[model samples]
Target: MWGGDRLDNYVEQLRKERGLNQEEFAKAIRVSRQTVSAIENGKYNPSLDLAFIISDFFGKTIEEIFIYKGGADK
Candidate 1:
């Protein structure tokens, strides 16, 4: 699971389920493929606008996409 509950794997899964490659999905969401790749690799934290775009693209809420693991849980 990429990034665990941080949403990277969720995005990857969603992208695959939609039969979208990184380039295609990135174009659909108006972001560079590198940005999408970075997000999936957990090398980037998406801006609020980008996050919303991703959520909307996947038909999921922000919380459903990005889950924050609190220190207490660790």
Candidate 2:
């Protein structure tokens, strides 16, 4: 669990920046569109494996995409 850490991600932004819709981005990461929607809406925190996949697809680190706030940031 992330404890008090809030899951903040820039997936939607990055996806649009790459000209990908949710379905396209989801396909790129091999997940369902619902999963991408959930992550973008902050309703789900991706597992480490999915996180790495997303990060790699965007050529970014997990910290760059999903920002874990409220722990050391506080």
Candidate 3:
């Protein structure tokens, strides 16, 4: 299982704060808008490199943007 729900991010909020739409944000980060949507929706987990890119884009640490909820049911 992917355990996507275990991962959380502030991508959408941050992007909006920066006045960037999904397509614009995706282009800035070299990913498809669909990928950005998935990240925001918690339907997909990004690779470490992409995560680093996103963190850098937001001027935040990876931990500040993406939070791991850990294994299911403790």
TM-score: which is higher, 1 or 3? Answer: 3
- Total clashing residue pairs per candidate? 0, 0, 0
- Native-to-model Cα distance after best TM-score fit, residue 18 in candidate 3, in Å: 0.4
Q: Name the regions of candidate 2 deviating beyond 4 angstroms.
A: 1-5, 71-74
TM-score of 1: 0.81
- 1-74 in candidate 3: lDDT tens per residue? 44267888889999999999999999999999999998898888999999999999999999999999888765
Worst 10 residues of 1 by lDDT: 1-10
Q: How do all models score by TM-score? A: 0.81, 0.87, 0.90
- Which lDDT tens digits does candidate 1 get at residues 2-37? 233443436887899999999999999999999899
- Whole-model alpha-carbon lDDT for candidate 3: 0.92
Error of 3 at 11 (Å): 0.5
**Candidates ranked by lDDT, best first?**
3, 2, 1
Instruction: Tell me model 1's lDDT, rounded to 2 decimals.
Output: 0.80
Number of the candidate with higher TM-score, 1 or 2 = 2
lDDT of each: 0.80, 0.87, 0.92
Q: TM-score: which candidate is best? A: 3
